[model samples]
Target: MGRHRNDPRGIAQMVAIGGVIVLFITLVILGGFFLYKSLPSGSDTAAVPEGAAGTTADPQAEEMPTGSLYIRAVGESSEVVVTVPGGDVLADTTLKTDEYLSFTEERTLSVTIGRPSEVEIYVHGERQDVEGEDPGYSFAVQP
Candidate 1:
């Protein structure tokens, strides 16, 4: 039958084709694995707790902002004289601890001067002062 028609050549061609197919399959599998790893991890979700979804917790989730202020007299029992803008005393009673004397509609704050020294007033964590006028030794707080 014409010397078996070069059977070795056909076997070699089949082996080459099989090698190429195996290489293509390996490349596809590797590409899929890399894509899965590049996707967002469980820590990226906002509603889920960190470290419980087989991933570390989000660093931002642990931080929170608590908006509040605490004011205290700079000295031991100084005369905290408080006033409104128009030379109006905040209240008839002297401002002390556990008292709410310096508030205006929950926005504007009345400042308290403890004595006749230069006093510094603050509102919302910012300085509120009069130009060229001494605030006296009273302390003020923002509401």
Candidate 2:
């Protein structure tokens, strides 16, 4: 056999080509990682316009409501059950005289009162009339 035919040069050349391919792949992956880190995030993309009415740059400003419901037990002790319309009950407990509760809901609420005269209801700081509703009455209120 000739020396050139039996030489190990071909194996060395194959290994060098494989090393170059691996190095090129590693560089491409690292470049993609650095590019991703330099880009702006999704939260920073939207900028609030200037001089817009009722527009706030704060992220929490969009979560608040314009009004809420306020309930108080005034004349005497009473048991109250507050439920969402056709849904689960939010509160089912007793309230003593001068005790107060508040909530914020966008839909109508079904309020069951053990003593209508003892419980007082308010919406957005305005007192609501509960004169005609008798004791053990359940009524619906919206906010």
Best by lDDT: 2
TM-score of each model, in listed order? 0.30, 0.48
Clashes of 2: 0
Residue by residue across 1-143, what tens digits does model 1's lDDT show?
A: 45365689887888999999999999999999999998868542322222221212132432221122222322222344444455654333332322222232233334445432232333444544433454443444434
In the range 65-91, model 2's lDDT, one tens digit per residue, is 234555566675778777776766667
- Runs of candidate 2 with Cα error greater than 4 angstroms are 1-67
Window of ten residues with lowest summed lDDT in model 2: 46-55
Task: Say which candidate scores most in TM-score.
Answer: 2
Q: Which residue pairs clash within candidate 1? A: 79-114, 80-113, 80-114, 81-113, 81-114, 113-138, 114-137, 114-138, 117-136, 117-137
Candidates in order have lDDT scores of 0.41, 0.64
State candidate 1's TM-score: 0.30
The C-alpha stretches of model 1 lying farther than 4 A from their native spots are 1-6, 45-143
